[model samples]
Target: MTVFGCRSCDATLTVPVSRVALPVHADQKYGNRPGSLAPALEPGTFAVNPLPSGPPWRRWAELEPGEAEALGWYAPRIRISAGPVGQVLLAPGDVRGAVIDPALVSDSACCGIDGGEPNMVCATCGTPVAIRIDDCGLRQAVWLAPLTTHVIGDDLGPHPVLDWADLIDHRPGIPPSEPGGGWHPMWAAAAGAALAHLLATSGGEPIVIPDHQVADVFRPTLDRLAGPGRTGPERTLVLAGPGLPDADGDLALIPQHPQTGELWPVAPPVRPVPLAWDAWRHLAFHRAPKPVGRSVPIPPEAPLALLPGPRFEPDGQIFLSVLARLPEVGQPWLRAIYDRGRPYSYTFHVF
Candidate 1:
């Protein structure tokens, strides 16, 4: 348990928190609705993205030569974040003594904040401490400003108890949709990050997921991107984890523990594609009995009842951003995907 306190006033600001890996989709922007996405990190958890993020933007042209390489971007972006590294990201609910100031919000965003500027101020001293972003199309998060806060307690006791087998007994079953049954942004974010990994090691051969529910989300885009294979079935990826039979396929979709961020162990020769815990859990139990409902039919010309979210386009930024960072990205075949690939943007839907 680490307690974060304001550097200026030394006031306690955050609940006891444990460190976890920065999620591959940490910065992902999902459906264009405020509060639509889950908190970037779970409560009682935090992550430090050593990579530079946040404001003080620099256009690609304006940057000095080699600046892009310095910032960990292998491919070009329209604009890049030139802010300081070591920013602390955790759920806003974990914050204890800070209140959001509407006036301090970054104006680049319309509905809520974009998080480049400080929106959270210390209640005791009014020192700018963090920024809260809960906007349409962006993640709902609170980023503790660099150097504004520090950890005062370090007694995080008995953490990382989520062993591979323990998760099944401890965590509740994960349903595919959010609380009222709509496409989950976490799913979109997970798909984006996992697709990058799937493509990176794919040798450009078409990807095949045996899980029918997961296949609906990834297989179509993968088929188009990697191609339908020149020869017969090359390999297949199937959901795999503790208490489940080993997949006979070439690849396994495995869980990265939510608390520790370590991928579940798999036997060698079976490559692993890491999905966040929730995503892995959902796919692992996709066959669990679910309530079935009858649908109300509407004319083809009539509009669907809802238009709350953007159509199912996987988060391209997450796809490319993650692809660019993979150690295997140097491979020529994998380089083409993030460097100059259209497969991520092709119109597709899995919902």
Candidate 2:
């Protein structure tokens, strides 16, 4: 767990927290319909959003020459944040030794705070140091004011990035289905992020993903997104991971390292698309070895299992959020899709 300190007093500002990659969809609305939005990072963890975010956004034309590209904006943006850089994000509940500044909170926003400025202050120095956001219809997170905090230390000594072989043995899996019977939120996100890569690498050609569950998750949208016929041969995407055979398809679906966020490297010509670790593990290794085509009859006393819902929609927000970051978005073909906001318009239900 890493610790952060208030820049003003050199006093500790946060509890020791594990660091994680900010979710690609962190800025995009998820769980915004028919339910409340949860905090971006879970308790005891934090991440840095490398991109500028929140308030005082700058229009593309307003950007000074060379400013946009330096900030990693390769393509034209309708509007981009000119706010604090490298904002630290964590659960609102995770904040410690701080108080919400009622004066800075937005009264017009419903449910809870939608802080654009510093709403959280250091308990010791009374300096405005963080922002707490919990607007009802939007995602909730506490973002530390950029210049107000500094790294103190990491409580977890020498955290090691696991080897792929070790990860297979130790890492836990995320359920594809949740207790209440819809696609698990993590599954929707994993599929959505991976789907963006599939489209980018598809070369605007038809893609064929053949693993039963893999195809089941991605095939519907792939068919829908492919435009009318060209006699071109199809492209295949197949699972590739540690302890699994080398992927023979045109594209290999691999797992990103849970701790390090590194992709399992593959050699030339076979393009790699990464899926979040737990999600990939669940898909690849969740099934135990069993006899094929040997059906077992259900016992008379057995309880029925809840089957998955017929429609499995990947969150479109997750798709577009990730697609916007990829270098492929600069291509004219993919650029058109990004500019048009395909995900928002597509009928496949976005979470």
Candidate 3:
């Protein structure tokens, strides 16, 4: 198990935990309302890396031309992000000697505590240690202050992600809305990232996700982004991932290895169109039950609601990151989407 401590004083700060791949919520906006359920982290696991948009970032405009080129970017229009120093994530229970200063809490979010900032200070040396996020409708976690805490314990080298065969029956599920009553960010993030890949690999053709759920989730944003007129072949987006059906279709949203971000290869081999592990699994399990189940497991208080309630906007950065990696960014259709600046402004309901 890995342990983190104070970098300045070497005082232990985090409980011993195993290293885990970065979570989808690592950069997620938590708490749409005061009483939402804050998602919990897996016990004894930690993500010691900063998520995109996490602290310790410099804007592209802040760098000189040589510095920007040194950072491996030919363009400065996009946000240049790097891992923050001393950042760590773990379950709230794993935190030690950290106290929530009530005064540090935000006035805007009062339903549950919104510790979005570094609200927890180390009781030992008075250093800002972490952020305790346990607000309703969001994931509960302790976001360690970068440059304050230090990690102690054996460093595990990068672990290979679970292969496709192992996840065939391990698909995950996501809620349409947050607990406190707001749209879930995962849908939009997923759709945006998926749209990026779809356009990048579309071969100049219009794409379609036959699955009503997926189409409903993505089509609005994609159509708006793809623009009104484009003459080309039609591509199909199908749920194709590990242990699932063959991706004989034009385009497949394959699952990336949860740990490694490695995409499950299509039979004949194709450019990777991987989704973040969680999102991929959500799509993979959208309709079919896990192969091992006779019926999907229902949460104790599952909401009996109609499908496709409302689509919320995705995290803009995540969407951009997904799209920016593709060469298709220069394409007229893709350029239009990029130009929208705030793609989330478009309102579409999933339910």
lDDT of 2 by residue, 289-348 (tens): 444585895444442222277678777767876787677878887777666664333343
Per residue, candidate 1 scores C-alpha lDDT tens digits across 118-212 of 89999999999998887877767888888688887888532555677787777644554666767666776777888888877665665666556
In model 2, pairs of residues that clash are: none
TM-scores, in order shown?
0.80, 0.83, 0.71
How many residue-pair clashes does candidate 2 contain?
0
Better of 1 and 3 by lDDT: 1
Ranking by TM-score: 2, 1, 3
How many clashes in each candidate? 2, 0, 19
Off by over 4 Å in 2: 33-38, 64-67, 74-77, 137-139, 155-160, 228-231, 288-307, 342-351
lDDT of each: 0.73, 0.74, 0.62
Candidate 3: tens digits of C-alpha lDDT, residues 101-183 = 87787775555666545787777787777787766655677888776777666665333334566655554656556576766
Off by over 4 Å in 1: 34-36, 62-67, 157-160, 229-233, 288-313, 330-336, 339-351
Q: RMSD in angstroms, all models?
A: 6.5, 4.8, 6.9
Record all residue pairs in model 1 with backbone atoms less than 3 Å apart, i.e. clashing.
1-155, 1-156
lDDT of 2: 0.74
